[model samples]
Target: MTGLLPELSPGLVLAGAVTAAAASLWLLLPRSGESRAARWLGLALGAAALAGLVATGRRLGGLGEEAVFLTVALVAVISGAATIVTRSPVYSAIWFALSLTGVSGVLLVLGAQFLGVATIVVYAGAILVMFLFVLMLAQPSGLAPYDRVSNEPLLSAVAGAVLLGLLSLAIGRLTSDTACCAVAPRAAGPATQAAAPAPSAVDPLAADQVARLGGELFGRHLLAVEVAGVLLLVALIGAIAAVARGEAALEDDRRLAAGGGRR
Candidate 1:
């Protein structure tokens, strides 16, 4: 079917460029400045997203079946890779954000604005901010201990490869080799009256596309959404517990000073 082929527009080019640039800057910064591994991973993922945007633009004339397939492949590869290759808690967090953003861009290209916005808002904005906050607060002691994590680099590599394989399979299956299903005859009428609608002003909440998203998550993917909420709750509790423990330890020292006759 041909109906799924998306119209290519100059706007796609601009969006691609902007996204690519943002991701590149995020990835390229030095660790001395902001964790090297994280920066490179973020940069690599950003590059991948840009590549997807470019591929999407090229396919804009209509991502014929083959183009759609290739586009999805690029996305799966990049996002999966980003998830695995990033080290450093903060860097991993940023790469995770990049992957989420990349998925959103792919959805946008496919005309799924609602899904795209949800991915970006939930994953990139809220979830990521939570993670970054945790990492910053932890200020992990001892670079030597952190460096020892590399001992499991092989395990990380294997896990990443498996993730990539699964993502590739999932995307490949979702896309058809044939162009999107064709538009029905009656649906093609009223070409003249089909003027393009004017764009609206940007709204922060509008970017979340909340209504469409609320319905989908609560209606179709109810179980998945609930599970995610539970996971988030667990993470929040754990974080609070950790901070409390650190503060309690500090308080013990203050009491020791006050009661121990400090000069």
Candidate 2:
């Protein structure tokens, strides 16, 4: 283990950040009667992880762009984590809404104007409102028992950390590769067509953006879009079923309490 200790390089910083995030998630995830100390510790670890990640990141050219991107990214990550960790379904849903806003900001910064706006309009404005209505209809008299415990918290944390680390490493490698960042010259062969610009430099906004997106969705990915629509419909149906069950359970609980008091 001593031999495995790496230098305090950017890679090491990222590794430490990933480890801290995992530990923080493990500590912060909803549990039965958690102590204040554990919550504080988790918050501290989470902050440390955020700092570490910031320290390891390469500058994104302009300071204004970098700051804006960083701010939105932080909001998204923090809110997403809060959504996962909050015991109250209401608060969790609110955090998820905030996360969606942050995600929209990030997409806008990346030049995907339509997608950015649509994410909030579709998810936050529509789907999330529906979820809130379901919550209102289905919420129990008190905190539900299932809300106090997450499914396999330890495994989930470890899996998330592993995935984060893997993605970080892949991104780091991909960005550091000079070829990936540079646009190569067009080939001289007579058969060669005009070379396309680098993906990062492509003016996706220059086209009839919404129409192109619609064409893509309804053309090549039509089946996928249909499947996603079906899934959303099923999820809405499930929410209705859950609401009915919750109301029934609440009724049963109230009847039992009334009978006990009378006896």
Candidate 3:
């Protein structure tokens, strides 16, 4: 599998291998009941995530421009996985926020600065806080509930096959055209020397990609983004109402108890 990896960056290769091993171990961890083994696995996954981040940072040479992109990707992968495997809802939410931030960082690296910022603002700043607030307000005064959802083997198998097929198709599409390939060399200018130097020369298809993305997003996908906003607003409203109701109910109960009303 070492030979199968690309020669672009060794950090990415190491990250991928560590990610795969962590995921496999995570899958094998017990789901239903509390397992000491699962807790240890989570710790191991977190360690691997830190290692991946360090490796990526080193490859990108510290906190340089490229380092930001790779760092975010590494952090997102690790945090996202940690969110699921952790037992505490609050901790999970924190990890999820970190993961979303990482994703936004990746988008920023891809030249989608606006989208990346929006992603972080919406997911981490707003939605994540709402989730944390709700959990704190609604948490029952008892042990946390743990109910493992079982999957049907046949259905799971079918789903896995479909996912694999779709992934293969996606890979094929991505590698199909030369335009979608790696960044191209910059065009030389009249006054420029023999070596045209540009640190971030735009990719050949960058303009086209941006145009297409804007067209689709502002045209066909416009409704989807709008709908997402509305959904988030509704969720926020619902959370507020739930919290208010809970507080009111608690007040009423307190009043009743103070009055010594008994059957």
Candidate 4:
């Protein structure tokens, strides 16, 4: 128990700090009656705290890798926090879009170029546009009541802290284990089988990543692909129905006003 204390202390501290920072930001977020300065202060403090948390992790990688990681990470963190704290629903949605862009950038850094581009095209382009259209059509006048105030801020902060703590512990343990495995010397052993030849980059079968991806998606995950298509179609139909309903309501109001004036 005494030896275990040393290992647990850092994680406990990180969890505590994250929880405090998250709670503070949540408490200070702009409610309908809150002042602007408090919101701004909270945003700044939250950003600083997040930066500190990332710095403490001290992720091991090349200089270029580290730079790219920090750049996209900061963008994702700051914009994500802003999305939650912003007063205007439209601005919040825009911030959320920026956060998604940062996530796509991270994916690119991690060597998933196809997935990154797909994320941008599908999420940032198509899905975000649909979201904005729905938001506009739903609340043409101004912010809705739900948007004006956050529900269960304390509970949300606690939940976020727990997730962050778990993520940090997982990353720390994985990195430490990787470092240990990398540095530890391997024992001499007899060869079991002949090694396979490495594939060449210029090889036709190996080069076309898109073709490989398509084969995997259609071959292995065809049901998931079909389900996704069905979901998109359902969402499109729902959006159309919602817009039609709003227009019908407006037309009815206009007709009633005209009838009252005539009477």
Candidate 5:
């Protein structure tokens, strides 16, 4: 067993540790009738697990970039986990919004300024507002059976662990391949022998990025872009319809209650 343990790769070890932590946290989580002590224990376990996961990552890029990345990534991860564990739908939605904001911050740190801004505007601003609106309209008293009880916690933990393991394996393989490519000797070829054309220099933070992005979207992926826009329109229409139906139902219920009271 000792020899077998030593033979296990670091990626596998990390994945196992993460999976165990996740499962432990899931088991410790507060059920419908669980004590406060259990909830506290779950929170502690979750925090430790999150810390361990963050510590496993290799920091890349400049000091500032790494710092920002870590901070935002931490926020995103913690809030995302909170969103899943929280009993209150309102709080869950709020946590989700915070996670979105953290993702936007991470995107900005990664030099995707436009994507960061769009994420903030579309997800945190618009989508979050819509979600909150729906939640308020649907559950004015904030009590729901689905919100109180999680569905299949053990199963979710197992699924999440498997997904994380696959992701870690892919990342490790990609990193190893990149390092090998970087250090491996390159044979001189005909392309190398020929005078290579001087590459055009473009500013990394150029203002015309949006224009270039628009050109690419409209030129090469116009159909996909249109489809996405159409999907968004459909979603908006559905949401409006749902809200209208809910309001009408509530009004009818109120009228019936009023008639009953008079009788």
Candidate 6:
């Protein structure tokens, strides 16, 4: 695959892959009166896209790491694409969880062990809470409750989350990330302060990956980490509270609909 990819320019390969991906998504998504040929074509395009993407990302030092990366990256890409296009919400959620797992693996391969682990933790909790919320909101009058929602309060929640994310990004940009690195000042002497290069230029070598990162995170930044955990705990509690309230309201509605109000 590597030898085969050299003839094709990276940009051209990427563009072709992206184009195939878009075509595949359009064909694969649910539609009225679909034909068999379109499904097969979509599958072919999706395979081609994955192959091209794998080829594009094969720049690691060893074949072993490349193989590992290729495996996880394919998992992430396939599941992520399927998540958006899958007709069933349950299938979509399952695909999304698999996608997160793949992403976490990729992060680990890229030397971000803590973040990789945190990604799984946060999203696992989020997905569980989301399922609870959706299940409670479903109309309990029998029939399939998958797409049988009365209304979508989740949309407003999503909107609020996006707004909050943007606000957090704005706040984050106001601080210097280099402060956490703590390398520039000590590495640069007083005479060389005027021409000291940015911390980005100097790459940090990791003799021990997980151990060093874990030590610093727990030993030095334990308080901040504990605070973050507390925040996560509070958020989970709030979500559970919301789910309970929604369930109560939904039960009342079910009773009213069945003509057994307050009995």
Local distance difference test, each candidate? 0.57, 0.87, 0.63, 0.72, 0.73, 0.70
Model 1 ranges off by over 4 Å: 1-76, 141-144, 159-263
For residues 1-263, what per-residue lDDT tens digits would candidate 6 score against the true structure?
55786788765676576566666766676655557898899889889877765655536667998789888888898898787667666677788889999999999887787788988988866765577578568636444544423233334434533564455345444433645644464635666655655543433323466787788889999999999999999998998999999999999998898886545
Encode model 2's per-residue lDDT on 1-263: one tens digit a residue.
11233457777888999999999999999887789999999999999888888777777768898999999999999999999999989999999999999999999888777899999999999989989999999999788999999888878999999999999999989988988766443322323324543444454354677787888889999999999999989998998999999999999999999999999
Question: Who is ahead in TM-score, 1 or 6?
Answer: 6
Clashing pairs in 2: none
Highest lDDT scorer: 2
lDDT of 5: 0.73
CA RMSD of each candidate after superposition: 11.8, 6.3, 8.7, 7.0, 6.3, 8.6
Candidate 4 has an lDDT of 0.72
- State each candidate's clash count: 7, 0, 0, 0, 0, 0
How does residue 142 of candidate 2 score in lDDT? 81
Better of 2 and 6 by lDDT: 2
Cα lDDT for residue 166, candidate 5? 79
lDDT of 4 by residue, 124-231 (tens): 899889889988878757666777787777677778777887887887788668555343222212231113232111122334666777887999999999999999
Candidate 1 vs 4: which has more lDDT: 4
Please give the TM-score that candidate 2 achieves against the real structure. 0.74
Query: Residue 220 CA error for candidate 4 (Å)?
Result: 2.6
In candidate 2 the C-alpha lDDT for residue 88 amounts to 89
lDDT of 5 by residue, 143-190 (tens): 677766677777777788778877877886777685553432233345
Better of 4 and 6 by TM-score: 4
